[model samples]
Target: MFEQIKVFFMKIWNELIITIIVGFFIRSLKKSKELVKPTINELLNNIDYNSKNWKEEIDKVLEIKTTVERHFPEYKDYLLIQYGSSVIPDNKLPSDYDFIVLLLGYPIEGNRYMHNKGTISDESNETNKDQVDIVFRDYLSFLFAASAGMPYENSVIYNGKLVKGHQGYFQWLKNITKNILFDKDFLIRRFKEKIIAEKQEFHKCLKECEEFGHDEYYVIRAGYYYITSILQLRRIQNFEKVITQNQVIELSKVRSFYEDILDDNIRNKYEQLVENLKRNNTLDLISIDDIKEVLLYIGEEYDKNK
Candidate 1:
């Protein structure tokens, strides 16, 4: 009886010990995961936008901003204004957000330069990578981009917030944006240069896509150039005012104004391509042959007009 009692107690103790060990292990694992995750404030405060290359900079900004806006809703108030597809209300698609941001009391007084404070990553959702570009600028840098006739400045002047605050600083930025963007000669020269650049980019992306396989990256870029070239060509031809990408797509869908000049088949293709780009965030579904043919048509039209 004594021996049996001892064995029973020993068995109970063994099971208890095993349970305690497993519990401890799980607790440690939970702690480690908590430590690995970054705080919301840390993520928001760490955005870096110092790249001089506008294309590369915008790419990074969009990737970072998507995560920021979804995870943190408070930051939307801080957003000055959004350009691009977000400016369109009825056109609901998973489009990138291109906007300006105001981060108060940053970079410090003496060390007041666009330097990063920390870093952020989106390990949670790897598949659907929503991207939007955010520009964090001080007064002088904003003025510089406005005065310098950079391509993106046109978007801001048209869509960005035009309010007065911080000692009428916002108004100052607005005035500068208008002064530079609205000049007749400046628009003419800028549109002409933009046309050439877009053509080159469209061909370059198309060639790479053909040489390499049909990659989503190259297709997206090609689609961008394709639509932008059409819009710029129309603008230059008619001496029309500036319009956003969404505006151009809208006009194309109805075969209105400049878009009415497109061949019925070309107009249909343009409509299909733009819709696919908007819905899937890529031009993967569109056929390469179709793309080439449409591009050829666009080139012919441009040549005739030019």
Candidate 2:
């Protein structure tokens, strides 16, 4: 009788112990999920830098470092950087928030999932509130870009602000960028590609404008690209270092400095375009032909130089 009682108690004890262990495991998993829950994930799609709420939107974007770190702790050396209009105010509403999460080491298989998780849904995202663009790149790719003197990589080296990561890593990036051996062929090809792409987009916008009423948004964007391509071509032609976006845009407005690049005919047209785009939200005063002429001039100049 005593043996039977002992066996029954032992079974009960075993079951009780298992129940305790399972309960503890469940509680731990729930706690972990809570602990790693991203604070920015909920707010990620709500960031906006419109004229009314730019200040608040900027504040929210600045907090992305913590979330990135928590989610991507596997890679110790990474840079979370902000560039483009998000960092530099160009007196117009930014098309989107640009960010680069540069992993400063070898790529890992797990990084695929990490990248997917942080990828912004900009294409299908109808609302400008979540118009975030994230470019995830590994060290090898970044190094190659720096070596080849790619414009965006160069801009990050020179103008990008570090939202998170070691200062040493960013400094190392700058150091490599300083000694970059620019690939002339690569640059020429890039310039050609940009000119063609912009020309197509500009013409498409013009067509849209003709079909619809006035598309100030796309027209302004085409102007922005035209100015950017012009500036980049100037750098390539002169073998000068690349400048910041704001500096390039500002310089484009001042035709006096670019007398050598812009002939009398092109300069007059460019000046009118710049004046209209800079002063107001409307494009009534600027002639569509002016944009076409400026683009043609740049394309001819690029061909000659290349």
| lDDT to native, each model | 0.51, 0.59
Please report the candidate that would top lDDT against the real structure. 2
lDDT of 2 at 269: 66
lDDT of 1 by residue, 143-164 (tens): 5545645444445655565321
Count of steric clashes across candidates, in order: 2, 0
Q: Write the per-residue lDDT of candidate 2 for residues 1-306, one digit (tens) a residue.
A: 999999999999999999999999999999999897443334544556355765445444544445445555555566777775557656365344567777655446767544522333232122221345465666556756555555656766677787666788888887876644544555656666667776777777777888886544456557656655656666565544443333333333343434645488877666666544443223565666666667677766666765
Reference-based TM-score of each model: 0.49, 0.45
Clashes by residue pair, model 1? 62-132, 62-133
Runs in model 2 lying further than 4 Å from the true structure: 1-57, 61-147, 164-176, 212-214, 227-231, 238-257, 268-287, 300-306
Q: What is the alpha-carbon lDDT for the whole of candidate 1?
A: 0.51
Clashing pairs in 2: none
